[model samples]
Target: MDHLSTTHSCMEHLKSQNAKKSGIKKSGGKERPESSFVAFRAFLSSCDLFYIKHTCNFISRRVQKHSHLVHCHLDRTIGNNAWSDLFPRARSHYLIFEASDHRHIISTLDSKKKKSVRLFRYNRTLCDNLEITQLVKEIWNTSSACSVADKITRCRQAISTFSNEFYVNIRKLVQLKDSLDAALSASLPDDDSSLG
Candidate 1:
């Protein structure tokens, strides 16, 4: 049988065991607190399950004051295999409670694998810079490619290279300015106003 089916069977077996001990005649009736606790404890003893903390600070229960903490538990094997090649990293998301007072938990496997999003950056200030205009003109005029697509591609590559270099230079200049500002501030007199 599958893992879920096995878990279900084990839970059922625990419930039955609890029921027998409690002398409960009916199976479909509301479960008693003792029976529920026994079953839950038995299930915990049988499997290596532990609770996962929720992302939010708010309690899962309907009442804000009362803290009813329930955790999302996974098999010990699953947790162990997460670091290995067999399984990927996983995370649990606690959904908002609507119909039920308790919040529902959903485990998402391979949570570390993220979809790459490419952002195209445009520098509007480049239009005003004469150096950038001259560089673009040089790149466009120097391309030997006969086809319009190839020429456009070459120009794009040249522009991208220029933009990357420009940004790096700008970043260094900003860093230098920040350092100078910090030094100036440090060297200043502690008395409220030295200039006045």
Candidate 2:
């Protein structure tokens, strides 16, 4: 099958790359030569990369949870539904970006819009319960109820209130500091320069 062959080839490529990386490293030591490619390969082998990979996985999971659709931009022609199945939630759209000379897939998470076709591949309880289904329907069918103008007005009002309070407090502090400094200067022996 094509899937099996593709999987095998991918595994083989990874193995070869790993072998090449190990070959570049100094014998019995992790310190790689100062060559740029060797440094990059060493970075791939580093434990920090494992942490970064885990962070990427976390981001992907979060995106999947929040979004039902994904859009991908890639240059090369891909197989039937290979990329789609990888992120099969609701509606997955892929576009080919041909301007970039190199072959790389750029994936973007699409916005959750009203009237989006719901993909119920998760827990059955989510769809089976009437209340849950109703909730999901309400979430998908209705756009943001708040108007942009109302949101802007509220934000501006908050900023104005904060600014007024901040300036008032600052003026009081400044007056208190001036009074304190005058009192302190009065208590001290007056210098000729200060009197002038």
Candidate 3:
């Protein structure tokens, strides 16, 4: 009964508020004289107030969510025994989320090793280097392996070595760019830092 009465009273209050917002005030039961310009201005002002209120609410909600997320983390990672065997030294780590709405979770398979985990990739820039042909020819011709697969693997290894040796300066520049990007992210974040 109390709940029903409270809801009824709230509806009455809303109706009264709507009536007050109808622009022209009643005067002796005759339609009140209100200028079109004044009515339009009143409508615009109300709309502006509503827009500002909602916008402020949205921004505050986002800020509150971001601020409260510093200690609150609810992310999950599921794997099987096979996965565990493949990556015995796997670990989970959190990534900072400043510009994004959701925090990130990273899983590193080998977090302790300082060795390069970079996979072999054939860059378009490699074609421009004139020494690539000579290196390939030397690798293919000098390989003593009889089996085709063994020869291919030997050539791949040689090419990998050549790529590393040839792109040493490029590697240094990449390191420098990464450091600069890190410094920049300290002030403003991009997509996500937790991902590799």
For model 3, the run of ten residues with the poorest summed lDDT: 52-61
* Alpha carbon deviation, residue 80, candidate 3 (Å): 19
- The residue-by-residue lDDT of candidate 1 on 1-196, one tens digit each, is 2355334422111112332323232223234555455755454444543333234312233322233322221121122222223334555565554455444555565567578865546578778978778877886777755577877666666677878876687777666655543332332223353321
Backbone clash numbers for all candidates listed: 0, 0, 0
For residues 1-196, what per-residue lDDT tens digits would candidate 3 score against the true structure? 2243223321111112122333332212223345533653464354331110111011110112242321122232333343455666666554444345433455566668598776756777777777876777777777755577877777677778887776688777666655643433332334355432
- Cα lDDT computed for each candidate against the true fold: 0.45, 0.33, 0.44
Give the best candidate by TM-score. 3
Give TM per candidate: 0.32, 0.16, 0.35
* TM-score of candidate 3 against the unseen true structure: 0.35
Candidate 2 lDDT by residue in tens digits, 87-131? 333232322222332222233333245597643234443346565
Error of 1 at 145 (Å): 2.9
Q: Model 3 segments beyond 4 Å from truth?
A: 1-91, 96-103, 107-119, 177-196
Choose 1 or 3, whichever is better by lDDT: 1
The Cα error of candidate 3 at residue 106, in Å, is 2.5
Best candidate (score: lDDT): 1
lDDT of prediction 3: 0.44
When summed lDDT is taken over every stretch of 10 residues in candidate 1, the lowest stretch is 69-78
